[model samples]
Target: MPRLLIAEDDADLGPAMKRALELDGYVVDLFARGDDVLVAVGVGSYDVILLDIGLPHMTGLEVLRALRARRDETPVIVITAFDRTPHRVAGLDAGADDYVVKPVDLEELAARIRSQLRRRERRHDDSLSVGRVTLDFAGHVASMDGEEVLLTAKEFRVLALLMRRSRRFVSKTDLEGELYDQDQWVESNTIEVAISSLRRKFGRDFIRTARGLGYMVGGLEA
Candidate 1:
């Protein structure tokens, strides 16, 4: 999991922000002062930063500019008390991703964090390796046991989605949505056929059936 730095100067809001992000599965580091944030940012590899524009020593804008000057690409969402037009624009210009005004909903803040992390995930697809199975999306290949297991396009798409979100049970409907036209008349068991095909081409144990729940695709260790 990626870490988040919550740099809020307000005494009450800072701990609240920390609790919200921590509940959402992020390892959070809190800094009540802007000067403290400068030291915190250098100490850790933060995936996203929630910065308050109004601060004691360094304003959020100055910190953002300083970070960008050092070529830091960590996504910074300016969580500011300032609702002025110039503040928002200046934050964006200073390399902030989005600006959230004060008195914000923690759920929406968490959603924004998730959106940024997902964008970063898609940007870097070095490869998805699970146990002995590997899904090379760019090369359009699935290899196991040091050999290419020839797969159809639909098989690849189904496998890719599962591999991307491996360890979770992907429902039949979700996989169907990924494989076919939404408006088209496809059989209810179309996904079953695809799953069966993938299992045959790869290995019988490649994807596990969860009875009525859905399909679990990947090794247990993966």
Candidate 2:
């Protein structure tokens, strides 16, 4: 299930939005403060973020700017009561993937989320290969040394992220967000388990660890 983080300050509207999105099958988290929204994004994984402009402590626009400043590409949709041209332009210019004016239609919100997710999926849809191991994402299959390899669902997701990012390090927190939903009870060592399993199948050098930082695809010997 897709996870969503909603930062809305209105007492009544926040809860109403949460319940509505939950009913649409999204695992939702609500934050009434803008700073809290930033904190949640740093520690939690969410497929899409709904940010309301009128937030306490910090405006949603400020929050969006901070997120983009860090190069975080998570899709964000700005939700606000301001439907004026300047507000819409400012939100888009500040890195919001989409914007919605208030009195939000839940159905429309859901559709927009789906569209962003689809676009994200397309970004990483290509088949990938490193050394003798090859991953066919379209077919949902993998092969190493000319033989088929079977991987658990979680394993595939880990491999896919690593492959797509290649040399770039993917932090544990980021990987966790992508691999599991917020509502799921995940063990602390869940990511470690997946990494260990991948190494066992593809060899240790297939993934390199940066001590306290994260994991990345290292140069695989041909």
Candidate 3:
């Protein structure tokens, strides 16, 4: 499931939007303060962000500016009651990927989110090959030497993150964050178990580990 963060100050509207987006097959996290949104993004990865202009602590635009300054290109959709041309332009200038005016229509918001996701996907190859293993991201399928290899949801997620960063070691903490949402309770050995399962399917050496560095798929010899 894709993860999303919503920064809206409207007490009633924020939770409502979160619930609606969850129903649309997304793991949604809601925050009323812009600073909190920044804090969440620091530790967690989100596929997209829904930011309201009128947020407490710091405004949405300020948060968006901070993200861009740090070179964080995660897609952000500005959701605000301000429908004026200046407001939209300000958001665009601040590096927002898209803007939606409030009284938000849930269906339209979902469509916009999908559009941004598709745009991001187009920036990368649909499939990645590392050694004898290949992962087709669009198809959500993994194969070894041209033969399809079945994988559970968790296994696929772990493999995808590793393969995407094929050259770098991915820490267990990063893997756990990607696998489970903020609200989900995770077992300490969850990532270890998943890695063990993946090694069984692909050869034991398919994923290499280094002390203190975490795991990697390809690049340097193990």
The lDDT of each candidate is 0.79, 0.84, 0.87
Point out the worst 10-residue segment of candidate 2 by lDDT. Answer: 213-222
- Tell me which residue pairs clash in candidate 3: none
Model 1 weakest 10-residue run by lDDT: 213-222
lDDT of 1 by residue, 1-222 (tens): 878898888989999989878887889998877878877765445778999988789888889888776555678999987898998889999999988998978989998999888876775375565557787778888898668888878777888877765546788888888867533666787777888998887778878778676877543323
Q: Which of the two, 1 or 2, has more TM-score?
A: 2
For each candidate, give its TM-score against the true structure.
0.56, 0.62, 0.62
Q: In model 2, what lDDT does residue 59 have?
A: 95
Q: What's the candidate order when arranged by decreasing TM-score? A: 2, 3, 1
Q: Tell me the lDDT of candidate 1.
A: 0.79
lDDT of 2 by residue, 13-44 (tens): 89999998899888999999999988887655
Please say which candidate is ahead in lDDT: 1 or 3: 3
Stretches of candidate 3 exceeding 4 Å from the true structure? 126-222
Backbone clashes, candidate 1: 0
RMSD (CA, Å), candidate 1 to true, equals 11.6
Better candidate by lDDT, 1 or 2: 2
